[model samples]
Target: MDFLKLPKRTSGNRTYGLTSIADFGTPIGRLTNILDDYSHIIDIAKIGIGSAYITPNIKKKVDLYKEYNIKPYCGGTLFEKCFYQKKIPEYLTYLKTLGIDWLEVSNGTLDIPLKDRLNVIEHAKEEFHVIAEVGSKDCNLEMDITKWKEEMQIFLEAGCEYVITEGRDSGTSGIYQSNGQVKSELIEELVKGMDVKKIIFEAPTSKHQMFFINQVGPNVNLGNVKLDDVLVLEAQRNGLRSETFYLEDADANYVNQTPTH
Candidate 1:
């Protein structure tokens, strides 16, 4: 394989085309175990969905994430609950007190109005870095491209740095099937005529990661990745490994084999 044929992939500590991980296990111990080997590869560390509540030493973990320069933030479900419970402002303020500079605002489990959602983003930005999510947690929720575009625009304009696409924790359910497969036609259409760079797709499965890297190129943003999948996902993104790139190389070699026929 010629070296130039392979595409160049982005390094970590990136803003755009970024990748983030979810910390779903024991907060401090798990963090120690992962960083003991893989901290340099990770960009963002998420205390996924109220895990901070379960882990009483939120401040300790927050400091650990920062010690590695890995941004620590809460998951969207917590933000949704706070906003729904009329404690949105309090949540943002409390996170700041704990040395957290990032927060996620999502409407996954609730129906937040477009204006209200943007308002949360703005309020969050006053004290923290904000990233908004685009998806529904309910299985009954259907795809509405118009709604997606509108919400994306509002969030981006509200000073949120990134608007994440809905792939759920398993990369399924909202924009995927029960078997954890993404609806490719819909994914292509969703990315069509839109800013592909600003959105992060939550792709927890290898198949989903391969598909996105194929369609949107290796530099696509992804989230909800398990800590152990870090190296594998990075290889896929950079064309370093993964069968998809191998197959592509094989096909190209066949086509260019001196063209005897």
Candidate 2:
């Protein structure tokens, strides 16, 4: 059987075209079932905001993600909580015990200074692969595009493997308007001003996912994806969904071909 050629995607432990799932306390059995089917396309599983501390069988869940070669780490908000309590050292120790090697250094809900955050990133880089996040989670908070670009660059220089643009799981903040529409102008400027491959845009909805895939091609790194949306997102990425069916790489001839009996 022949398959139609679709848009090519980065595969097998991708650095780009990453799909990061936000795990909000999925049961180990359910998570294992999901990974068995979709682990090839899933790169990162973020134990959503402070839940890792309270979730049952946390070690087993983390180890399960690792077994499928997915990098599982606690959410940035958890890091902020640790920072607020001045327990960052203890947080690192806790993560080490869980076999987590990726860390998200972010200041979305907290007011940690840029210098302090960079210092943390630099220090954390020695032991973990850091992915720093920029922008606030509050929809009412406004941030300058110039500052966003500058901070992302500095984070990369500070040894962050990727810098996340903080469109929260709701898709209503940071790189998005209060109504969940993307800040297109801001995104355009960001794409032009930096190495897009190093930036992960949090796109939790179908609309958000399609927009990023269309704007940055299928290989754009996206985060905050729900576990259930994984397969649909991959379908959209490869032009298997209506949203991305007209991607540039799609074959025009296939559409125009005459039918045969």
Candidate 3:
């Protein structure tokens, strides 16, 4: 089983540079099956949106993900909704009840004051592993790369373990154009003067995943990966897929075969 050695992937428990998967209402059995099949490559299992509420045995599912060393937590939209509904405290209590220790704090849909966002980061860090997200989900509410860089810096300083670049689950908006194409110039500029490793890109589609992996290498932190795509993503990460063929290491033992007259 160990004969075909592949590139080393970052450990699931590694503090940064993670592969975060979105659990979009998958039944517990399927969720556990995915984890059982590809736990080694999955770092975080995000309970996307408020959909966790409808999931049966959600707590057990969270615990199962944890048992595999995958940090499971609700999405930032769920937090945003709770905050606007005056249920931040209740949400925190509910998360605790689920035995989840990771939290995603973001204001993609609503406008949250910088001071307050930082305050939440400060507060959440005390009880949870906070991953703060930057950028607005609305395509019209775009920020330039410079401002995105500055905001990510502030969130990191505010004690967030990692910051997510908002590319909506559809692979549109935020760091990407409405057409699902990445702003290459923007991405290059943002990583130039920043700790690129600390940024997790939300690349939900295979195209988006391949683009980021090609641009930033295999260990580049990626998010919003679907449950079924974990192994496929891992294959791409290790140059085992056609899209990543350029990443494959050359055969060291090969000799040039030339037909001589």
Better of 1 and 3 by TM-score: 3
Highest TM-score, which number?
A: 2
lDDT tens digits by residue: candidate 2, 154-229: 9998889999999998999999999999999999999888888788999999999999988888777899999999
Give the root-mean-square deviation of each candidate in angstroms: 6.4, 5.6, 7.1
CA error at residue 111 for candidate 2, angstroms: 1.1
Least accurate 10 contiguous residues by lDDT in model 1: 252-261
Off by over 4 Å in 1: 1-6, 246-261
Once superposed on the true structure, which residue ranges of model 2 sit more than 4 Å away at CA?
248-261
Residue pairs in collision within model 2: none
- Candidate 1 lands at a TM-score of 0.87
Q: Which lDDT values do the candidates have, in the order given?
A: 0.75, 0.89, 0.81
Q: Per-residue lDDT for 40 in model 3?
A: 82
Candidate 2 TM-score, true structure as reference: 0.94
Q: For model 1, what is the error of residue 219's alpha carbon versus the real structure, in angstroms, after optimal superposition?
A: 1.4
Report clash pairs, candidate 3: none
**How would you order the candidates by lDDT, starting with the best?**
2, 3, 1
- Model 3: per-residue Cα lDDT over 47-161, one tens digit each: 8877887788888888898899888999988999998888888988898999999889999898988888787778778999898998888887769778988999988888888
Q: Count backbone overlaps in model 3.
A: 0
Candidate 2 or 1, higher lDDT: 2
Query: By TM-score, how accurate is candidate 3?
Result: 0.90
State the displacement of the C-alpha of residue 31, model 1, in Å, after optimal TM-score superposition.
2.1
Q: Which candidate number maximizes lDDT?
A: 2
